[model samples]
Target: MVLEGLGKSLRDVLGRVNSSSVIDEDLIKDVARELQRALLQADVNVQLVLELTNRIQDRALHEEPPAGRSPKDHVNKIIYEELVGLLDNGEGLELKPQTIMMVGLYGQGKTTSTGKLANYFVKKGFTVGLIGADVYRPAALDQLKQLGEKVNAEVYGEPGEKDAAKIVKNGLSKLSGKKIIIIDTSGRHALEDDLIQELKDIAAVAKPQERILVLDSQVGQQAGPQAEAFHNAVGVTGVILTKMDGTAKGGGALSAVAKTKARIVFIGTGEHIRDLEPFDADRFISRLLGMGDLASLVQIAKEEIGEDEAFEKVAKNMLSGKFTLTDMYQQMQAMTKMGTLQKVMSMIPGMSKMEDKIDYDASQAKLSKYKVILDSMTVNEKDEPTLIKGKRIDRIAAGAGVTGHDVRELLKQYNQSKKMMGSIGKDRKMRKKMMKQMAGMDPNALQDME
Candidate 1:
């Protein structure tokens, strides 16, 4: 969650709008002012913030609600659109085979971003090859190689080589078979002449289809000038903002780069190798405003679960209200594969609004304890949890190195999940309606669910 503070502020203001009895001039103005405050506090440029707030205010006050749409829903729609307008407008990169060269200043997580980019392509079923053309920084090649290994991509690096252009030329020849070839170029402390020259030379030899400039979101307002400089030097086609998950200044970086010629193509959401996500302004803003991104969630679920019969069976069992502890454990493993609970929740249709209320850290620890408890149960106990009571609970607790209370807690959670799933599964109309709502959801429509 990038710019979480700003998101919380915006959601709170929207919550007020929904609860208000009247949507009038004063309420619109108040919402505008609160939005300005939130964006400014998140390090968005003052001019951009004013411009965005102005648009939101004008639209909300003047635009008539669509037929059957309430004034509150209309205002929320205006806010969602205006906020999305503040970011990238260009079509993102194509998934076909292409050469991509990564460039940026040192310490901007450029090397790590290379790995992330490679992972993104690999997940798309591309055969990725990483070229470690970064020669200046000590261990830069080693780091790239390690990341390449993590993503299972081929790496071509000439260690101790001084000429970056020559290394890229040779590496391109070596890794030409890969569908996606990403060259990680050298970086400097600042936008220096030497670094620019090196990038130019590498681009000349590589003729990369995409020259992506990586920037640290924490760079704040400086991200604009940096992007301009790189784009001028090597015709940077796109930008990747890193460290977005932990930075308040991500809004600044995002807004500033959107002003530049190089539009954001990807964003590094976290430290994990798989945290890089394709930048979609609509989806990004939807998640930010506590409206879920079901498209991205489904994509992640597909990548994690695929067509596993075991998972399908577990899901069916859960829906039938006949799932065992073993089935519950399988479901937990699938969720873990998708992402952190907070991230998964943010992608659900209406769960993002509950993110702040839940204690995810405690919940994650509890899940771990439950896994240990499940591991200690006998096969029969796992299949029929109701059978484990009294003495049985005590024996399982001792086996799991915990008190009987812990075992009971696990059962309580399982039963709750089973009950909820059963209710949803039994109601065919409710399930179909939910699926329809998710399949063709408007941003304003999210408010109804919330």
Candidate 2:
């Protein structure tokens, strides 16, 4: 539903096909139409989307899929491949101790992403230092210090250094222990001469190994020009898109990668130190198309379901719609294996800002209550939601050690799950759309799963 409009467009084009049969030009055109519409809706540059779709159409009509693949399957796979090809290839930075600079406009997550980047390097076994070169901003130094403390990285800044260049020069001079030194620069609301001069001066001082522009994913189409503007001024080597856990207008970041001739090196899914991930284009666009990011899911599962039994339990439940609160509780616990709820929420686009309004501690406590309720029920009752009637509800309430209302809430959630699965199963349009989404899956892995 998040991609409601784009969903309609995709269904309109891809919905016509139902089997593994060969497709015609009409079908390809329709699929291209839907892709064009979805990309535009996602705030992709109009010219780029058109060009991309044109290539898709040509490939669908001209190229042959692998053996036994259906026409729809062929097109779906082709689109996935071409889309990745359209995105600029990811470039790896030289794995040496060197200076890296963060450049962006105000409110673009420059400082936040810098800290995350530093944390990323530290985990990768690099000693990293931070030079708070944003002396223009009143609170930049303190903010970087607080962030540095979280990552246990060194922060270099004096109490009242007014010149950004001076702070960077001093920071670099004293830098001894770390291989990578990240200089976080200040930004203005728009491109201004003073800020530009200061950035140039910092670059001259640091002679950075790489200068990365931190672009906000929410900026959509505007990301391209903004990236170009910075690239023109400071000559960015790579870009990092942040706030990827929110309603990320994904097209913008993709466009930024395309427009600036700069590769995306990392993405910021959360505000936490470990929230940054190295760029992987195929997985990223797959999720953008509402197909799900299985790689990310696999990462989560590896951490949460370290036990084979636990992994199998949730995977079976997810595919069969037999999920329960106990199951959900285990899933929640699995999620916690990675980090706190607040940190996890920041990784999911729609779930961002959840802690801002939701009662986090209470919500976790509710999960615990539901866990107890499920534990009280017979295994059969846990499997079948419809079987939990009044007497069972009371027994479960007493067993879970919560109010009867709590049992009702658990049933409510289960009902919601059933309704959603049923809707996904019954809708002809949804089936066709989901089939196209199957393109994102690794055919070998899926076959193995089957």
Candidate 3:
């Protein structure tokens, strides 16, 4: 969803401009101009915009899409492929037992990204280790330890060490049997020569397969110069664009790419560990021009959500019996991720008409009240909402700041939803159809609802 607005705007303009099926030169030119304007407006570099536009125009004019496909489809494909090519043309990084140095300014997310990348390697079935050479602050060591615990990666650091370079050297020596070692270094407020020298000394010991520079996305044009400075100092092999969930233009990233000519390896979309998206040039650009990108979403879900958790969810539904309130709550959380009812409904071809009746706001509001009621219940009450006799109901109701009837209302809604899911489980074809429909919603929907 990094390019959400850019994608939407391009889609809107294309949808409105052409009514014909023919792939005319004029229409293509118009689309290119509009797209260039859109990318440039998004804070993309002028040269990058021109380069993308040229590639899009050249291929779209000569390309022959599948028979009966809309001209828009071909254009979307060209945009996706070209952007992807621009983004990731280099051979992918070799995945081996070598070090990866994460560098960025203080507060630029080196500490978090180091762990996320290590988590990625761990999820891929690699034995990963972490060396937190950041001795600038004791809080940093704690931060790395907490993140390492979350990912279950071994973090090596000296809490009292004053010299960052010595910490890196000693930490790497202690860690054994790791296929991947990520060293998180101390950051500075700006590009200081002393800091650069310190990083070089650490790099000499680590011999990193990759030295990635993480940067904020809100700096607009300033990102180019910053990337250049870092590249010149310690040599950046790749860039990690962080904080992309906000409305930041992130044009600065484009500048950084131009300045360093380094590949973008990963992007941090949100605060969650699973919010990292491996850079994909093709599908991303395609989506920017209003074509949906499914590749990244599928990868994220498959990697982050364990197969066992998925199996549990699937197995419970197969029994065709009463689903407990616990199950209902889990489903509500999943739906919160999948998307709003109205948005999900819109993806279903015929259900577009039912959008007005979906009552998403009402449903979500009711869900909030349901959670409150659940929190106030005793252990016995949660297991059996029916066992909450009038006296217990009153106590629970007062505890949750709601009427006893509101508690009953929550149970009623949960029961109704459970029955619906149970019913859906009975119809394999319908469930499959609904799942497909849900997948077609925006990627954020998938993340939000699931």
Give per-candidate clash totals.
Answer: 0, 3, 12
Give TM-scores for every candidate, taking all chains together and pairing residue i with residue i. Answer: 0.65, 0.65, 0.61
TM-score of candidate 1 to 2 decimals:
0.65
Minimum summed lDDT over a 10-residue window in model 3 is located at 291-300
lDDT for each residue of candidate 3 in 83-194, tens digit (9 for 90 to 100)? 6666664644566677899988888889989889888988888877898878775798888898889998998988787777787777777776788899999888877887
TM-score of 3: 0.61
lDDT of 1 by residue, 21-77 (tens): 999999999999999898878777788889889999999988998775668867877
Local distance difference test, per candidate?
0.75, 0.68, 0.67
Model 1 residue runs over 4 Å out of place are: 292-450
What tens-digit string does per-residue lDDT give for candidate 2 at 284-379? 444444342222333333433343445445545555766665555555454434335444333332332222544556656655555567778887
Tell me how many residue pairs clash in candidate 3.
Answer: 12
lDDT assessment of candidate 2: 0.68
Clashes of 1: 0
Give the poorly placed runs of model 2, Cα more than 4 Å off: 1-22, 92-95, 292-450
